[model samples]
Target chain A: MGGYGEVHYTNPTGPGTPPVASLARFVVYLAHSFDDRLALRSELEVEDAKVEGGAAGGEVSLEQAYLDYRLAERLTLRTGLVLPPIGIINETHEPPSFNGVERPGFDHDVIPTTWRELGVGVVGTVPGKVGLAYRVYLVNGIRAEGFSGDQGIRGGRQEGQDASFANPSFTGRLEWAQPGWKVGASFWYGGTADTNSAVGRGAFAAPVTLLSADARYERGPLALRGVVANVSVSDAQAINAAYGQSVGSRIAGGYLEAAYKLLQTLSAFARHERYDTQADVPVGVTRDRSLARRITTLGVTYKPTWNTAFKGDYQLVRNAAGAGEHQVLSLGVGYQF
Target chain B: MQQPAHPAAPPAKVAASIARLFGPGARVDTVSVDTTDVLRVSRADSLLGFAAVGNVLGKDQPITFLVAIDPADRLMDVDILVYREPYGGEVAYEPWRRQFRGKTAADSVRVGKEIRSISGATISVHAVTLGVKRLLAVLTAWHRSGAIR
Candidate 1:
């Protein structure tokens, strides 16, 4: 048994917005080895730290629950709710592993991280001097009713909650890693119109396609990371018309980060991100410029131990519309065991 | 943590690997000590090197690995014998293990320092680094004390 958690203090530099302190997340991990060939792994999470009967906000959810069966040296079958193998932060987002107090905006708006769905997949590594790893899965599809212009397909994530299987999606990732460098590419293709007759009902109706590439390099005290992703939606106009919503046909974004370890316990980092949820709007719909965003973050992280981090960061948030620009100051402490 | 005992006899694959690494005529003998067991390799009255098996926790389960050292106390090679974790098995890859070659007990043997860190296998990388460092220290002590000479 093990767990991880984080606490945060944030002060957004905007009118009438009060500074807030909160327990951002608390998680517990459980695992059982049934035998030499099979095992079960699970993670239970609490967001906002509490969930009361009448509370307005807070949630308790399962982030991961899967069984792994080792079939060979190069193959393992995984079944149950699983995180799609895409992008850097999706599967390896332990707070101590990242730089800023909060995750990059590109991950939040473009990738919709902490995203999981019911699926079965195979994960393995190819034996060679060139270390190669891969994962592939087929998962339940998203619900188009939750699609929106500002969030794109993020709200559509079923998160394994009675997820509809009428429109299944395929997702996979391939990564090549060596001592000082790692590079990866991933893709997700699936339909979202799950039993919504107005948008037509079929596995291929209102399909969403996503492609992403990411790279990380670390040598000595300097580390660099970058990720880019593009998402395309088919039959967006029909879905928007049927649901009375403004959904985009394409959403795109990326981020670049660099960090340097000034001391064994302290590291400094900076990141720049740009994303547009409404990169391209469907016919008869007006694009919202505010949905296009740029964020620049500068931060420092102190790690007294490998599994604990104290973080502080300043964020300059900008939008194409230029009306709601704001700055944010955040501090946080996080740990994993 | 208590050290796990090495098997009474090295597996055939491991024996073959030892022969392949040290030469066909290399002979290995088990040397039991207070802390752990060591495999002393030699070829006709001349010492070739020493090899020890060590186990370290990776995430939740133990990862068993073998470390070989030359007469000069520098690492000759590292091999993962058994890995039970579902993830972080990348630590067993050749390219990653190769980093330990020629390193001595005096070296840091730290992840992100002398050793390169794997993207998704931080915990295992760290655990193995420390385990190898500890094994190197034990071998160095044995070498100085004439425990196996």
Candidate 2:
């Protein structure tokens, strides 16, 4: 659970943007093992405080539903709805597992954390000092019609609905890890336009590709991490003119975070995040500075147990437009079993 | 969904690890842990050490690993014979595994302290640390109670 209060600083003396408290999300993870070689895992989530099942309500969706089969010591087969092996949190996010009250903006706007799709894949590791892991999958692709000027591909994610397969996508990740250090790279490439759908009546397949990389280091009481991500769209000019939306040809951003444990159960962290959902537009389209966001967050997390945490953070969000900068104070508590 | 229950290291891998720890010519015995046989590495019937393999949850899935303890109850070495998770393979690295050497129950044998933590592999690091702690505790008990000599 999470709640935050925000005040716009664009006009310091004037009335600020409203402050609000919200229960951000509730999620449940389930897994069942059939034996030593096969298992099933799933995550069901509720966004916002409630879901009325009527006109005005929150949303409920499945984040992961997959089965894993161990084919060998280093190789495994996985099928069903699975989070693409991208970014740091897309596959490992269980609330208590992270440091901030909310996820990094780069993950939300660029990499799209919790981005799962119906697919099948192989995941394996090569052991030693130069430990390595790799994943490759064939999955359903996004829809261009859902792409927007403000959210970029955030809305384009089909989330494993009756997803189209006119042009399947491929997502892959590779990581190299050593004592106290890990570095990884991931990518997603596919066609978004449905050649058969009316929206693509006369347009070529609009291919969308995303590339990302991250690194982390932890030793003793200190931890450091950073991530960089960018999405490039082909045929954005025509697609924007046809859909009347300003989905940029490129959206990019990244973040860096550092944390130190003051005590066994208490830690202080600071993060800097920057992202521009509309970083680059088509030749004739205008860029919206507001779409480009940068924020510095300071926070502390208290963990009474390994799988539970209470967090509080203050975010100083800078407005690129220089019109509505704001500060947000947030608190949250989370647990996982 | 069929999951692996009590998934131990494969026989060939277990044998190879034992030979590596002891010598290639050392004698190996299979001692019974309830109904399951645990590997006992030795030379000419004199006990060199015991090889214990077990599984613990690493993030969402189980990580299977082996622990080798010398006669004095100190860890000789740790070898990740089989790891089922996707992200925490760092625990299998030789340098990271080497950190647990010579540690006993008297030591914390916990991550973020005695054992260095692996970034992005926190769960696996913690799990293995706890596993080593538990192994030491069991070995200490056996030594004190005369179950092991």
Top candidate on DockQ is 2
Clashes of 2: 11
TM-score of chain A of each: 0.98, 0.90
Interface RMSD of each: 4.4, 4.8
Lowest summed-lDDT stretch of 10 residues in model 1 chain A? Answer: A124-133
DockQ for the candidate 2 complex?
0.55
The CA lDDT of each predicted structure is 0.88, 0.78
lDDT (Cα, tens digit) per residue for candidate 1, span A246-284: 889999999999999999889999999999998998897
**DockQ values for all predictions?**
0.48, 0.55
Residue runs of model 2 more than 4 Å from their true location after superposition: A1-18, A127-129, A196-204, B1-9, B31-38, B57-62
**Residue lDDT tens for model 2, A146-182:** 7888788878787888987776899999988778788
Looking at model 2 chain B, report the run of 10 residues with the lowest lDDT sum. B31-40
Best by lDDT: 1
The per-prediction tally of clashing pairs is 0, 11
TM per candidate comes to: 0.95, 0.90
Tell me the fnat of candidate 2: 0.77
